[model samples]
Target: MRALVLDRPGTCDTLRPAELPTPLPGPGRVRVRVEACGLNPSDYQRAAYGIPEWEWPAILGLDVVGLVDTLGEGVTAVGLGQRVAFHGDIRERGGFADYALADATVLAPVPDGLEPARAAALPSAGLTAHQAVVRRLRVGKDDTVLVTGGAGGVGGFAVQLAARAGARVIATEAAHNTDHVKRLGADAVIDFRGEDIAARVRELTDGRGVDAVVDTIGSDSATANLGLLVHGGGLAAVAGRPDLNAVAPFGLAPSVHEIALGAAYLLGDHRSRVQLSIMLAELLEMAADGRLDPMLSRTVPFEDVPGALVELSGRQVRGKIVYVAS
Candidate 1:
């Protein structure tokens, strides 16, 4: 297997080509021949954060759509050659290669209408959005919800899902993406670059703040965005850095939640794994029916993985970027 391995945490140069042995499934796992993989923010963050425990030459991709090559002992759900999509196992080699390992508990069959690149795009972003808006916040009819970074991958999905749940969806994005965000089902789009987001939200809601907020953009602005939520409202943020000091002064006393799909998938417990699998299946079904769109931005050949990482680091992509296996 030829893989783009990260020798250490640093620039794109850290990713170099090397021939490694193909991984075989261990007990309760599956070996998937990679067909397509999605590049995610977490992939770059894992390298940039340079966590002390991370091993050198690590494979960093997360979302994979591939064909099952073999199954490990105790696995009975899928057979060889079935097209599947799942969260790629975090290890020495990942979906950036020709093959990757996956836990059988997380694998979901690719439905008829979903393309491999689109399927690859769904795992991380789709699961994050679903868990944050639908599960954690319990957004529903008549609820006013604000989603930041609304044109980005997870934020776009959050907008769609919240609108689908009948929430009055308000999203913040660059002025150029106003129409793009609106097409994704946002009831109103705020130009984060030129407008006061909190003021706009207050105006939209008749001087009351939103019922909940999903923050995909983590920064000082994200902390202030929390002030846009009504008292006792909720927040589900993907970014961990928020100014905790601002929480109470807002007088909202909001419930804060973080979306950690990878942590739950890697929990190695049967119940957690089963719950993730079910959620993945439901998301895939929605994608197949065209009710949910992964919003694939571009698909490049596997050789472009390293360069794609560089481009993704700039944060210019509006939606998912996929690597199609040769």
Candidate 2:
């Protein structure tokens, strides 16, 4: 199998093309013949600073859409040749090659007529947004929700899902993506580069603050958003950890939800891992019916994975990028 192999943790230059033995599925796993793999910021992060549980010579492409070639022993849910998409576990070698392995529990069949590249864009980002908005925040009708990075992969879906749930969606993006995020169901778009996001959200909510905030761009953004929520409102963080202490003095009773889609695999949380597949199925159905957009902005040939990682690491990508198998 031809794979972009990472022998050591470093920059994108550390990735090199090599013909490696194709991986086979072990018990309770499935081997997918790679069709498309999506690029994500986490890909570059893992490549540059390795995961604590990951081994050397890793392959890093997390959002994978492909056909199941073989099923390991005791796997009864999926069968051979079924087209599937899943968020590849980063602790294992990922989908950046001709064949990739996954636990069968995580596979969701790609809806008919959905393009592989489009499906490839969904699993990780879509799952995160779904879990944050639907499961954690429970965004509902007439509620005002704020989504940071609104034009981004996860934020785009968060906007749509919140809107579909009858919530008024507020999103933050670069000035240029204001129109794009609006089309994705964001009722208001704030330009984080130039505008005061907190002030704008207050204005939009008439000084009440949002019912909940889905924070995709974490770090300081997460902590800042805590102050923009109504008392008892939720904030779901997908990226970095937010300082809960920031809201301590206010006694806002803010609901802080930590969303880590891959943590289910890391902590051996079987129930949450199973819910990932359910979330993928629901997301794929929405995409197939046009209720959700994969937000795929670019499709490149598989060999461009290395350069694509470099491009993604730059943090200028507005939407998802998927690389198809040659």
Candidate 3:
């Protein structure tokens, strides 16, 4: 199998193509013949900063959409030829390769009617959104939610999931992505660079602020979303941590959450894995029903991933970029 192997961690030029033996599953695992792998922020983070736990010449992708090719000991729930998707420590031989071994428990059968690229996007971002809303925040129907970077992968899914549950959502994005955010179900879209996000969210909520907020950009934007939380509201961040002092002015009983979907999945917890699997299944259903969609900005062939990673590191992408495996 051919894969993008990291000879050194920092740049695209260092990712050289190499031939390696196709990996097979071990105990309670399954080997997947990968059809697609979704590029994520974490991918570039690892590529640029270097993961200490990451082995050299390792494959760096985590999101996998593929077919079950072989089963290891104790695997019985899913059979050969079943289509599935999973996210985990592809840190050894990540999903960038044509074959990956995953714990069977980590994979969920791709729900009927879901496209592979779309399915590819669900494991990481969609699961993060689901966990934020359902597990951590427990958002309700009447909630007014605010999402920073609403046009982004996790934020985009957060917007839709919140909207689907009947929450009125407000988003802060660049002017160029304002319309895109609105189309994804935001009741109001504020251009963070130009508009006062906290103020607008306050006005939309009658100076009461929103019931929940997800800050995907983290630092600079955490204050904005924290300010928009109504007293006693919930908050979540995909990118940054909230300063408890900055959140004090809101006078709300604020609960801040950090979403580390990769680490969460890496725990190998059965309950969390099962929950994520169910969430992925429902996310796929939502996509097939048109209630959710991957804002696919680019679809490149597998070999182009190295060059694509260079762009991803610069943080200029608008939506999910999938590698269409040949």
Please report, in order, the local distance difference test score of every candidate based on alpha carbons: 0.85, 0.90, 0.82
Best by lDDT: 2
Taking all chains together, the TM-score of candidate 3 against the true structure is 0.94
Tens-digit lDDT track of model 3 for 1-326: 88888877777647888888887789989999988899888887777777677767778778899999999999999999999988767355688888888878778888777778888877788888888977788888999898878888889988988888889888888999888888889989988888777677767878888889888886767765676777788888878787778755546778888887766455657876777677777777777778887777878897799888788877778879888787
The positional error of residue 61 in candidate 1, measured at the CA in angstroms, is: 1.1
Best by TM-score: 2
Instruction: Report the error of model 1 at residue 213, Å.
Output: 0.3
Candidate 3 RMSD to the real structure: 1.8
Could you tell me the TM-score of candidate 2? 0.97
Any idea what lDDT model 3 has?
A: 0.82
Misplaced by over 4 Å in model 2 are 248-250
lDDT of 3 at 321: 88
Model 1's C-alpha root-mean-square deviation from the true structure amounts to 1.9
Candidate 1 lDDT, 1-326, residue by residue in tens: 88888877777647887888887789999999989999988788777755554556677788989999999999999999999998755543568888888889888899987899989889888988999999999999989999999999899999999999999999999999999999999999999889988889989999999998889887675688777878888888887656767866647788888787766644656777777778888999999998988899899986788888888888878999999987
lDDT of 3 at 86: 86
Ranking by lDDT: 2, 1, 3
TM-score of each: 0.94, 0.97, 0.94
